[model samples]
Every structure is written in C-alpha cells, then in structure tokens.
Target: MKKFKCGVCANTVYFENFRCLNCGHALGFHPGRLEMAALAPGRDKRLREARRGPSSPMVYCANEAHGVCNWIVTSHPDSGFCDACVLNRTIPNLADPQNVRAWGDFERAKKRLIYSLLRFGLPLDGAPAGKGPLTFDFINDAVTGHLDGVITIAVGEADSVERERQRQAMDETYRSLLGHLRHESGHYYWMLLIEDTGRIDEFRHLFGDEREDYGAALERHHVQGPPPDWSLRHVSAYASSHPWEDWAETWAHYLHMVDAIDTSVAHRIEPRSTRFFSGTARAIRGQDAYRSNSFSTLIERWVPLTLALNDINRSMGHSDFYPFVIPEIAVAKLGFVHRLIRESTT
Candidate 1:
C-alpha cells in the first residue's frame, strides 16, 4: 500500500483509480514495476519510451478493455492478464448494471490480494487441463444455470452494502476482499500440504482428521451446533464445522499476521522489548522480511500491537478488530503455516 502518483500529471493516486480525478488520464497498473501508470492516448505517445526500465517491464491489465479495472501491469508477462485478473474463476453479471459496480469492488480487493502474494512470492499458475487457466467467469446464472456441482460466488459479495449487511448479521468485526482471498487460498494450499508427510499429521491433529466424511460433517454441523466450548479449540464458530474450514480459517489468520506485521514494520513502529513473542509488533515496524524472520522476534511486536489496535477498534464502537485468541496451540499452528510458506517458496 505504498503511495502512488498520476503518471500523467504527477498528482497522487490510489491503487484503484481508473482515471486521474485531477488529469483524467487513463491509468493502468504495471505489475513488473509494481507501480501505477497514467496514460493519455493521443497525448502521451511516448509512454512506452518514458518508462522502459530494466528491473520491471510494464504493461496493462487486459480487463481494462471491459472498463472494470485501471491497474497497470508492471511486468511484460507472457500472459495478458495481471496477477489479480488471472484468478477470477467467476465474476458477477455485468448486464445487470448493479453488477458492474460490484465487479469494481471485487477487482480492487482481488488486487490487494495479489499485492500480498507477490510480496510474499507465492505461486500463481493456470488451472490443470479442462480446468482452464486461473481464469474468471463474470456471468449471470444462465452461464452456470445447469451446473449443480459448481460453486458460484453470489456477485452480491462484491457489493459493499450487501457485504456489510451480511457481516453485521453474522456479528463479525473485520470483513474485506483481502480476507476472502486469504480464506480461499487455504483451500488452494490444501492441495500442496496434504501431500507432505512431515506436516500432514500435525495439521490433522489440530484441524480434526481430514479423513472424516466432509458431507457428513456438514450435515452434523447443520443439525447440531458446534460444541459450546468450540472456541477453546477452533478459531471461529464456523471453523468447527469441519477440518477443511478450520484449515482455511487458520490460513487466513496467517496472512493477517504476516500482512499486519509487514505494514507495522514498514511504518517504523518499534517494539518495547525483545522478549520471546514480544517482537511481533516491533519487527513489523522495520522488518522487511517478516516471513523468513523468526516468529519469536515477531511475537513481541504482534501481541502488543494487536492489543492496541483491538482496543482502538472497540473505542470506535466496533467489535475487537481481531476476535480470535492466539493461545499456545494456535501459536504452534502459525509456526507450521510459516514453515509451509517457506517450504513452498524454496
């Protein structure tokens, strides 16, 4: 979330701006350079020459053709779509008009997710044969009308008003597009982790035996609520529904910790002391390599900062910004998550 400028007029811009409110310059995200570019067709014919740099070859998101996003592609990638655009398995129905607005929100949030993945050096690949590239399908029910097995994201999740209503109804503190990305990534990573012998047993022990029947577990969770003491074990009430959900929840939390700590460090918030687990907050303030660095160093910064931020959110009449408690067991699980990310990158 670094500051950006309008390449056309030099005015500052946001990551989501399509046209410079100041100069009306068409904008695109260049992933290779990790910067936004302003384009003035018929005005700035020298754009290609202006920004031809060695480190990051620049391009633009193809979705800009549809007028949905204005992010520039920083890399001269083999693929036309940027990292965020590539993950869209299903987009909303734009013909409905309202969906056009929803698509915009989805794109912004998806970009934020891409930012984190790129920052962390996660992999993004096309789906296997028959699955197609990690492509998105922005369509109405008619496109998937006959499919029973396919999961369709109700475009409504893209709507802020609708999403906020759902969040309130569910009594949750933090809900955002980035959160959804982290959660969904949990499912994606399952394919990677379940194959590993070293990590499989520990994951099973904490998340419940994945061997248990998933459909049956869902049915049971529906008919009978999670045990009243579910919080003592699971991070969220919904997580108690199944081991798969538990994994997703934990994965999302891991992203949360990593990103939060990274931002804190970027802002230069120093830790009070360097005791075990006391550095989480301080490390974030200046630690550029939050993931590869030791978790013990991070705990010092994270624990205190999480507490202070939570209190600030409550002061504003909101629920605690983070609702889950990180007990010793969860801490161990987070360590596993860190290891998994390290293993994946290596």
Candidate 2:
C-alpha cells in the first residue's frame, strides 16, 4: 500500500484511519483518486476536501454506519457506497457485536484485496460484458470457497483463533482472510481470463488438464495426500489436489509477491549488505513491481527480499514472514498468470 499523509497537517496517516491524529481532520479514502483525503464537514452528511474546500462533495460509504468502511463516494443521487463496498452481496448479522467486529476484519482484508485488483487494472464488478459480476458473501457456518462469481467467506475465518485451528487441522503453513480472498478470486478470474477468453489450451499445459474430475481429485488428495514430491512442482501441497487449485494457489502467490514488492517499493525498503542479501539489492532498487512487464524482475527482487525478511522475523522470534518457496515449475505457472493479467489489462 502507498504511504499516506494527512492532507491538512501533513502528518502521516494510515489507510484505515478515519480521523487524523495530528490535525483532528476527518479522513476518507477517495476511491477514484486512490488517496486518503482530509475532510471538512459539509451540509447534510456530506464532506468536502479539507485543503481544497467545497468544490467536490463526498459522502461516506453506507458501510461507514457499521464502522467497517472509511471510504467515500461522490455525493450524488445514485452514489452512497464506495467502489469496494458496492461489491458486497451479503454481510453477517450486525446486531450481534461479535459478528460486527469479525466482519470489520473481513472488510479490511477484502478492501486490501480490492486495492490490489484495482492497481492491476482488473475489473471489479464484472467486465468483458457477459460474465457474471464479482460479489462477496460473508456468512456463517459455511465453507469458504468460490463459485460462479461469488466468493463466500465463512465468518469464523475472521476469528484468529478459529482460523489458526483450521490451518492446523488442514496441515497448512499459512492461511489468512486475505489469502482466502485472493485464492477464491483466482478461481473467478480463471473463468473470466482463461475459460472465457479461450486460453484453456495454454492453461492446461502449465496447470495440467483442469478437465480432470475435481471432486475425485479433492477426495483422493484428502485420503492419499499430495504426492511426496508436491513442493518441487507446486507452491503448496493443497495446490496439487487439482489443476484448478494449482492455478488458484499459484495465482494467490503471485498476488502475494506483487503486493509485497509494491509495499517494499512504497516504503523504500531494501535488503541490507549480507552474504544472503547482497545479490538482490540492486534488482529492486528503483523498480515498481506492479508496472514492471518483466516477470523475471519480480522474482529476482522477491527472493532475496524474502530471505532478509525471514531472517528479521527470526530475530523477533516470529514465524517466517513468508513461509513458502517458489520452485522452478511454480515460477512458470506464476509467469502464465502474469502474462494473463497483462493481456487482460492491455
């Protein structure tokens, strides 16, 4: 995420900030401008830019009433929600305070996911005209997965304790709400970019035949487990369950790498001079990973940076910041995703 500052007082602010700490100005993110704005109150729940005055009128997204969104939409007859909130088809019951808090976590992660999608110039509400519109459902007592265009997230996943328990039960090294969102979104985009665009032949070559019986693949995966050599060819063991899963897992990792590289660039973070880190320092020095057309450049920058981060995490006695490795074959799959996204945007 890009670093933000208060437009009124120039003090640093964060993406989720609703009020500036230094100047006490109300802050709202303008989705179109892609920046946080310092706000001054206007008539009838409207807000105007703090520094620029009342030229542009804005209103907080309706989700703001629940304290889950801090984004603003244009003040107009048809605009009441920000670009991100408009994608929600259902939310957990807000009457329960526990559900309210958990849903807040879901929205924060979902917004970050949406922010990355926007940065990639991907369509949020179903582009290419004929495809189903992308939407989200935050519900209770259901498995988290994607079907058609809707991504369903189990509300329990927002509870850190329950999420960790599920991760352990599944024998997974890493899992989070954002990870779930990115992975499910990968499924949605596969339908759009690969299936809809008639690129399945290319996808089959890299990910194997997605035509394989998915239910059988998953059942066999659970009973027999991934092949012993899974890590050599896939980003994670679960990815080996089916061709579609391989695509989604690899796609999620691609997003992870891009977002990490983008944040590193935004904060000007660089690897230090050490035997493990010296080789990659120059690769990331001035590059913007999101706009870079070279997939090789992203991997070059990502590897050493992750190594350094892993070491730092060890110093703090925390788990590795990134726990997975990208093998050569996985790199090829990720490259396919990179090209697919670039082609869609161009």
Candidate 3:
C-alpha cells in the first residue's frame, strides 16, 4: 500500500490506477518493484531491471467487455490466471454480455485484493485438482452469496449498484469487493491455522468454536440479530454470528489498519521521531500521522487516531468509518495475526 506516482508526470496514483488522470500515462503495477509504474506504450510493458526484480509478464482480462480492468499477470508463473482471478471460487457466465461487465468489475476489485496479498506476502492457493492456482466459479445456485450452504457468494455482489444498495440497506459504509476478499481469506486462513495443530486452541478461544455448524450459525444470525450488546466484544455485528466470521472480520480490519498505516508512512505523512501521540493536542493531530509504517507501529498509533477518526466522521454527517472497537481480547487476536504474518515471511 505504498504511495505511488506516475513515472511520466509524477501525478499521485493509486495501486488500482490504470492510467494517470493527470497526464493520461498508461500505468501497470510492477510487482517486482512493489510499485505502480507508467508504461511507455510499446510491445513490452514488463519492466526490465526493476529494482526488486524483473517484471512478471501479465495480461489483462479478455472479459473486459466494458473496459473495467487493464490488469496483467506473469506469463508463466505457475498459472494462466492473474493473481486476482485465482481467488474466484465462482465467476459469472461469459456467454451473457452483462456477466462480462460484472466479471470486469469483479476483476478490478479482485486485483486490488491480490495486490494486498502479494504486498503483504500472504500465501494463496486453489481448490484441489485445478489447473489454476486458485479456483472460482460464478455460481447461479441458490446459496451464491447467501449465508446458507457452504459459504455462498451471491452473484449480485459483482454488481456495484447491487452492492451499494445492500450496503445502504445494512447501514454500512466500508463494504466493498476488496472487503469481501479479506473476509473470505479469513475463512481460508482459519482452515490453515486450525489444521496446523499448534494454533487450534488459541483460535477457538478467541474466535469461538469454529467446529460448530456454519450454516446453522449463519441461519441463526439471519433470524436473530447478533447477541445484544455485541459491540462490547466483536468488531462488527455480523462477526458475532460465528467464530469463523469473527476471525475474518478481524482479519479484514487488520489489513485495513496495516495498509492505511503503510500508505501514511510512505508519503511521510508524520513528522519523524514522534511515537504515539505525546499530549491531547498531539493525540488529536497525531491521528494523521498514524497512517505511517507497519501494523505493529500502527497498533501503537491507532488508539488515539481511531478515536479522532470516529469523532470526525460523526461530524461530517456520516457514521463511524471504523465501526468497531478493538477490545483487549481482539488486540490479542490481532497480535496473533501480526506474528503469524511475520513468521511466514521469516
């Protein structure tokens, strides 16, 4: 989540930027360099001699029926699917032109998810017996996006308008396609951690008995709202529904904090040598500085910053951007995530 700029015009850019709005310079993410760079239009968009390494050859989605994405992938890095495409458990039908548009929108968001995973060095894999590293199917089944029947991802999530409508109905501001990826990755990682033998107990204590029936739990949640006063314990209302979901919700928040802090640091948003906010005034002003650095440091700075952000959002006629409070117990859970991620790379 480092800050990026157009190499051609120096315009500040985002990881998802395909072309600079300021100068119209074509852009591609050079994962080797861990930065987005401008592509000088030619045969080879792959960046050679990138400081991190040579660029991985990538191609955009051919399903770009409406030009939603310009993402590319490594030509021969173990699969034909781009990093984002690998995570799809189901994709919409290609025969229907509208499905193509939906897929394109999904691709844009999915690529953003993949970028975070790669940026943070998270592990990724596909379902068994697939040629691709990750498998997805845009299911038309009844449970596709429902809380019932083995984790349904409703096809409607691919539609921006539909997602927004749902978000409004639910009184949520921060939900997005990328949010879905982080949430789902929680399920994937829980499978990994529980199967690891050493981490199962800790997982159970913090997230609840993930062994419980997922479908039953989800059904109960839909029928009856989360435990009254759920906010005292969980980060989101939906998280209180199940242990697996609690972990996923927290995991997504962890990523949000980590990425937000990293982006802040990359841009020198904070004055150097300052730690956590020194005084009340410092604490107020220091929220802006919290964006800098790794998750470890972010946790240190986020306490005051989140408080400030909550108040600021309230003043602006919007609900809290970060709706949940990170309880002491949740902080411990997050610490486990930080340690696990650090240990993985080490």
Candidate 4:
C-alpha cells in the first residue's frame, strides 16, 4: 500500500483510517483517484473533498453502515457502493458480532487484494472477453475455492486461531485470508487470461497439462504427500498436486512478492549493506514493482529484502516472514504470470 497523509494536516494516515489522527478531518479513500481524500460535509448527506471544497461531492460506500468499508464514490445517480464493495455477492450474517468482525477482516484483506488488482490494471469486472464479472461470497461452513467467476471464502478463515488450526491440519507452512483470496483469484484470472485468451498450450508447458483429473490428483496428494523433492519444482507442497493449483499458488506468491516490495519501497525500508549474505543488497528506493516490466528486478530486490526480514523476525523470536523459496522453475512460472499481466494491460 502507498503511504497516505491527512490532506488537512499532512499528518500520516493509513488506508483504513476514516479520520485523520492529527487534524480530526474525515478521510475517505477515493477509488477512482486511488488516494485518501480529506472529507467535509456537503449538501444532502453528501461529502466533498476538504481540499477541493464543495465541487467534489462524494458519498461513502453503502457498506459503511456496517463499519466495514472506508471507500467513497461520486454522488451520482448510480454510485452508492465503491468499486470494491460492489463485488460482494454475499456477506456473512451481521446479526452476530463475531460474524461482523470476521466479515470486517475479510473486507480488509479483500480491499488489499483489490488494490493490487487495480495497480496491475487488471479488469476487476472481468471485462472485454471474460465470461462475466468476478464476484465474492463470504459464507460460513463452506470450503474456500473459486468456480466459474465467483470466489467463495469460508468466513472461519478470518479467525486467526481457526485459520492456524486449519493450516496445521492441512500440513501447510503458511495461510491467511489474503493468501486465500489471492490464490483463488488466480483461478478466476486463469479462465480469463489463459483459457479465454487461447494460451492453454503455453500454460500447459509451464504448469503441466490441466487435462489431468483434478479430483484424482487431489486424492492421490492426500494419500501420499508431495514428493521429497517438491521444493525443487513447486512453490508449495499443495501446488504439486495439480497444474491449475500450481498456477494459483505461483500467482499468489507473485502477488505477495510485488505487494511486499511495494510496501517496503513506500515505507522507505531498504536492506542494509552487509557481507553476511554476499555483496551489497539491491537498492529498492523509488522502485515501483507494479509498473516494472522486468520480473528479474522483482526477484533481485525481493530475495535480499526477505532475507533481512527473516533475520529480523528470527531476532524477535518469530518464524520467517516469507517461509517459501522460489526455485528456478517457480521463477519461470512467476515470469510467465508477469508477462500475462503485462500483455493483458496492453
């Protein structure tokens, strides 16, 4: 996420902030401009940018009533919900306080995912040649997965303890709401960019043939864990189960890498020069991972930075921030994702 400041006082604010801490000005994220705008009351329950005055009438997304969204939309006839909230097809019951909180967590993570999609210039609505717009279902007692164009997430995933329990039960190294969303959305985009675009041959070459029976592959994976040399070929153990999964896992990691790099750069966090790991760490200052066409540059900066981060986490008695390693094969897959995204934008 990019660093934001209070337009009123220039004090630092965050993406989730609804009010500036320093100046007490109301803040709302303008999705179209992709910036946090200081808000002021306008006519008829509308808001205007504090800096721009009444000319810019805006209204908070309808989800604001539930205290889950802080995005704003123009006060036009058809603009009630923001771009992100409009994708919701179903939200967990809000009558229960716990469900509300879980939904909040899901929305927060989903917004971050949406932010990355916007940054990459990907079609949020699955436009142009897509089968339909992408939608989301935040439900309970359901498995998290993507089908057709809708992505369903089990609300329990938002509970840290429950998520961790699931992770351990599944023998996974890492798991989170954002990770689930990113991984599933990868499936949605696979339909659009790979299947719809007639690039299945290329995808098969990189990620094996998708013609393999997914159910049988998953059953076999459950019966027998990933091969001992899985790390040499796949990003995660589960990824080795199927070609589609491989694509999703690699795509999720790609999003993770780019987002982490972007956040580090925005916060001016750079890896310090040290002989402990080899030569000087790559300079990430002013680097924009989303706009860059070079996948190698991302890997170069990501490796050293993750090393420094893992060391910091170790010093604090925490596990590695990034637990997975990107083998050469995974790098090629990531590069393919990068190319697909870049080509789509053009």
For all candidates, the clash counts are: 37, 0, 20, 0
Candidate 1 lDDT score at position 18: 73
| Clashes in predicted model 1 | 37
Off by over 4 Å in 1: 2-13, 19-27, 37-59, 73-80, 126-152, 168-174, 196-198, 268-285
Best by lDDT: 4
Question: Judged by lDDT against the true structure, how good is candidate 2?
Answer: 0.88
Q: What is the lDDT of residue 30 in candidate 1?
A: 66
How many clashing pairs in candidate 2?
Answer: 0
TM-score of each: 0.78, 0.95, 0.76, 0.95
lDDT (CA) for every model shown? 0.64, 0.88, 0.63, 0.88
Whose lDDT is higher: candidate 1's or candidate 2's? 2
Candidate 2 lDDT for residue 240: 98
Which 10 residues in a row give candidate 4 its minimum summed lDDT?
273-282
lDDT per residue (tens digit) for residues 1-346 in model 1? 5557886578888777777899787677766566777764333332342333433334566787777666655442566666677566667656767878777766776677667767766655423312222334444442211121122345666667867997787556566666765676666566555534467887887777887898898788768867797777766776778888778777888778777766656555534544553333122346554455576655565677787778888899987867777767667666777777777666
Off-target runs (Cα >4 Å) in candidate 2 are 74-79, 127-129, 272-283
Assess the local accuracy of residue 319 in candidate 4 as a C-alpha lDDT between 0 and 100.
85
RMSD of each: 4.6, 2.3, 5.1, 2.2
Comparison by TM-score, 2 against 3, better one: 2
Order of all candidates by TM-score, from best down to worst?
A: 4, 2, 1, 3
